[model samples]
Target chain A: MAKNLLDVRNLSIHYKIQGGWVYAVDDVSFTLEKGETMGLVGESGCGKTTTGYGITQLLASNAYLKEGSKVIFDGKDFVQMSTVPSKEYKGYRKIVEYHPEMREYRWKRISMIFQGAMNAFNPVFKVGDQIIEAIKAHEDVTDEEARKRVEELYKLVGIPVDRIDNYPHEYSGGMKQRAMIAMALALNPDLIIADEPTTALDVVTQDRILGEMAKLQKREKVAMILITHDVSVVAEMAHKIAVMYAGHLVETGTTRQVFKETAHPYMEALLAAFPNIKKEKKERLKAIPGSPPDLANPPKGCRFAPRCPYAKDICLEEEPPVVEVAPGHYSKCHFAEELYGELGGGESNE
Target chain B: MSEENNDVVIRVRNLKKYFELHAGMFKFWGEPIYVKAVDGIDFDIHKGEILGLVGESGCGKTTTGRLLTRLEDPTEGNILFEGEDIAKLKGKELKSYRRNVQMIFQDPYESLNPRFTVQKTVMEPLIIHGIGESYDERVEMVIKALEDAELRPAEEYLDRFPHELSGGQRQRVAIARALVLRPKFIVADEPVSMLDVSIRAGVMNLMLDLRDKYNIPFLFITHDIAVSRYMSDKMAVMYLGKIVEMADSDEIVFNPMHPYTKALISAVPVPDPDHKHGRVQIKGEIPSPINLPPGCRFWPRCPYAKKGICDVKEPPLVEVEPGHYVACHFAEQLAAGELETGEEAKEVIEESEKIES
Candidate 1:
């Protein structure tokens, strides 16, 4: 079996709002193996971003992790030990400050590629110099060594080495995003969290960037958590898939199993809602009837019960447990087995 | 509902929109640089048909829409709406033109006035156009427009502010505002891009219903090809302020002639992993509009560009097949399957085993 890189269990996050607490992430749990790419997909207000932030310890001041939430990274409980500043490693002291306990793990162990590539770079500095600074900040390396690493990174991301000296304004949108990916890979981290990295690029440009990123991840054997609202994007590269609703993980499975043998009604609805390029045109897209539930005051039972077509009396009165339909596929639905029988293969469960 | 009955509602001929770029340090002495946002593009929208103007950012798709709606003044060309050139129309001519041709913006939240209630927001257009005889008549018209937009119990939503409504609801209100005038044409610029995926379909379906019921022609502008293919009867591919290809949505999708169009169609991510593996590689980024290339704007990035010929001569939009127009130096080569060697081309050809011929 592959070694596990990250394990998150019962992870819940809430934001202190004006009236009441906004439950951003509720009882979310998943594990990622080395060299695996997991896609966390959801709509606008879903807690996919919050789950990523919770793992990285980068939640805002207004946000707080609920009690009993645990994040284990490489066997170390990050939630428990995220406050102790590192005193052992004396490298990169001048560049990166060891303030928060999680600071040491941030760029060195795990990194994030933010949503917008336009705002990722500093306006005044050259792209090459900025990357070198990032490298020097994370590791005990000379300016020359960092510069060499930056040059290699640029090449890895398919950027010309000469254009590294160009300012942010000088580079095109796609080139800037490639540079952002290069920066994220500076430390050769164990895991990477890309939050809608290609949302801003053109379709052609988005394909190129994603293909390149997928290649890099495979070559380096690095685990990735790609967060996006588009299911098609995740379907391209993700090995494992996790569907998030208002604040819960509605489904989890391997890419093949989830796409072929989907067990949740929410997943089915999402698949139907997606506009497929390969499929013939339909009269109208199958839209989920109602909007996502409000996180401030969630409904009585399942969060998706209001919009689910298969929603029943049991779905309305009690929360559904995460049931394993197949050996590896799990879905949070009251009738996961029935759904598997109905939509997955159309065979009787008996 | 046949080709014989279809009438050309709007004809855009050689539309151009040039924006002046600032010259740094030599502001007074140096010659001004013009960014040709929409450099002489031509197309037509038939009655009650959805013409999808598809392109990436800065491709002049939005500018073309704005020019047609009279929101932005076109530097050159004739916008023939109902046999009259409305490009240079002013005063009362412009006012009446605005009433006939309405616009639906991309951002619903920003498009609506937060201070105004739903009733006032929809009524503003009718009031400006002087449509109703009295206040009560105008109120009745507003209710009917809201109902037409699929916002049921229109009276209940009249007093609600824009903030109280959802993103999809707000877009419905925007649609209602546009429909209140009973416009002959509607320019919907990325109307559903801001809404969530689940909510997006509702708005899209609503637009289709309105198109069918009102028989209103829509110049739908979007970057998303899937949505465009779903909503449009005809689609035009734009690149660097030029129409690279234009045809029936099926023809443009199934048998793309232009290399740029093929690459664009291939670039869209399908929800199936089994569909394709390798990406269609376009060499470089979209060139800046200010310093467009000499021969063809897309020559630098096109994979099938013939070196000497493509760089020296601009390809005119020609009809190689009936009703399908393509602008490419090697359109013949592309159609012949001569350039279909790579994985990208293979993927595009076999986009699905299920697509009906």
Candidate 2:
């Protein structure tokens, strides 16, 4: 079997608050093969963004990764390299202290298409010059080479080459997002983390952009971790799926397995909540009763216990084990086996 | 259709609003240029019916909502509320008309005053309209409104400010404030777009419940077609400044006639992984409303547009079916699947294929 392009295990991230810590991400584990897309699906404040940022080590100052977390990319454990002492060096010396190598890895090997493309670019710089600067920063290329590359990228992303010389303000919202995608692919990175890349664009623009991106990802064979709250976008783009709740990964599986054989109640509710144009008309969406629990003081046991329709007393007393009901399909619930059996029967109880 | 339906609460005919764009510094120019935000739209909202206005940004859905609520004056056409033309109403008359109509803004965080407590926010409408004789009466009204909005134990939130409440709660407060006046018509502009998916259902259900209880007609404006279809009984698809299609929500979603409407529906991402829609991807971005095409506004990006007819003359909205209206010259042929897909659309489809290999 081919090696996994990215593997994250027991990844936990927390942000320091005034009084204590906000457990943003907890015990999340997933893997992605080259050219595969894994969607991190969740609501706001669910820590999906934190997990994406943690992969690139681009988290804010207040955020910290918990000990024992592992981010193994291409067989190299970044967590271990950043924290553990080097065996080849003298005593009490940590290898790659402060991650000076991370700067080289970032944008060169892994790039990010951030949310809200409006604020991602410098207002004063020409969009073409910005992409050229990114190319020049990563590779030993002359001005002409970088300019030619930027023009090629613009054509690849379906933006007219003439618009490349215009300022970011001169471009439309969709064009700005296409420019952001161009920059993320400027250096031919092995992996790209797109955080809600098409959230602000219209549905038509979003569909076009996602189509372009899927084609681009497949052609380049670059792995992707798509972080978004829109389930439909993920269902269309992602090969694998990970459903996140308050601060935990509630479910992970192939997109088909996750959608067709959903085991977790949170994932079920999320799918039911979204209004589908293809569904039968006038079906009232089942709304989860309460908001997500406060991260500073999350609920005991299963974090989604309060909102889960099938939650029982055991769900409140102890943390549910991550049960693998099917091959490569995992659900963090005490009743995963039972739910999987019922879901397999093609009848889901309300 | 007869205009004098007793059930209709609000009737708009040939409504147009043109925002003047000043060229240079001349006060009196040769000819004043207009943005033509909401140019000649017509629709009727019956009591308890939700007429969804769906379009992309700059498509003038919001402007139509504002015109209906009387927030902006129309340059042409009439907005008749309960048989009275409310377009020219001013001062005390307009203030009284406002009592029967209210608007719920898009952002709850920015819409509500930070300093005003829930009690004050809900009661201000009553105070302005002079609905209640005493402060105690207005307080009671406020509490009732809050309860109606599903903010259970309304007293708990009466003293709290907007900052203290959750986003959904703040929107509920905004709804409560709108309901305090018992308005005949409501203009909800993207009420649930800002909310999370789980919480969004609750707000949308709440609005549905309110409509059932009060029989208040609503002009629901949003860019999301699925949400619009779910919330509205009748749906209108807007392009630039005109209603390209109008029909029952299900008919419009399932059997759209207009090319633009078909493109919009096909563009929406379905949550089901196996669902593969026939891709009717349109080429290019939406044209600027300021410099709209002379003929059909959507002709430039339309997949089935003809060169001479579509570009030479504007198509008037005609009822292709009994209750379905479409503003396209080849609406009948398109609905029958006889019209060929334009070359540009085929090229766009080839260019946007997912994973060519």
In CAPRI terms, where does candidate 2 land? Answer: medium
Poorest stretch of ten by lDDT in candidate 1 chain A:
A88-97
lDDT per residue (tens digit) for residues B81-170 in model 2:
998999989999999999999999999999999999999999999988878888889889999999999998999999999989999999
Compared to the true structure, candidate 2 yields what TM-score?
Answer: 0.96
User: How do the residues A65-120 of candidate 1 rate in per-residue lDDT, one tens digit apiece?
Assistant: 66667789988877666532224322101112244657888988999999898898
Assess each prediction's global lDDT (C-alpha) against the native. Answer: 0.86, 0.88
Residue-pair clashes per candidate, as listed?
0, 0
> Cα deviation of B265 in candidate 1 (Å)?
0.8
User: Fraction of true contacts kept, per model?
Assistant: 0.71, 0.74
Highest TM-score model number: 2
Q: What residue runs in model 1 are displaced by over 4 Å at the alpha carbon?
A: A83-100, A281-283, A344-350, B1-6, B22-31, B339-357
| lDDT of candidate 2 over A276-298, digit per residue (tens) | 88776478877889899999999
lDDT score at residue B64, model 2, on the 0-100 scale: 94
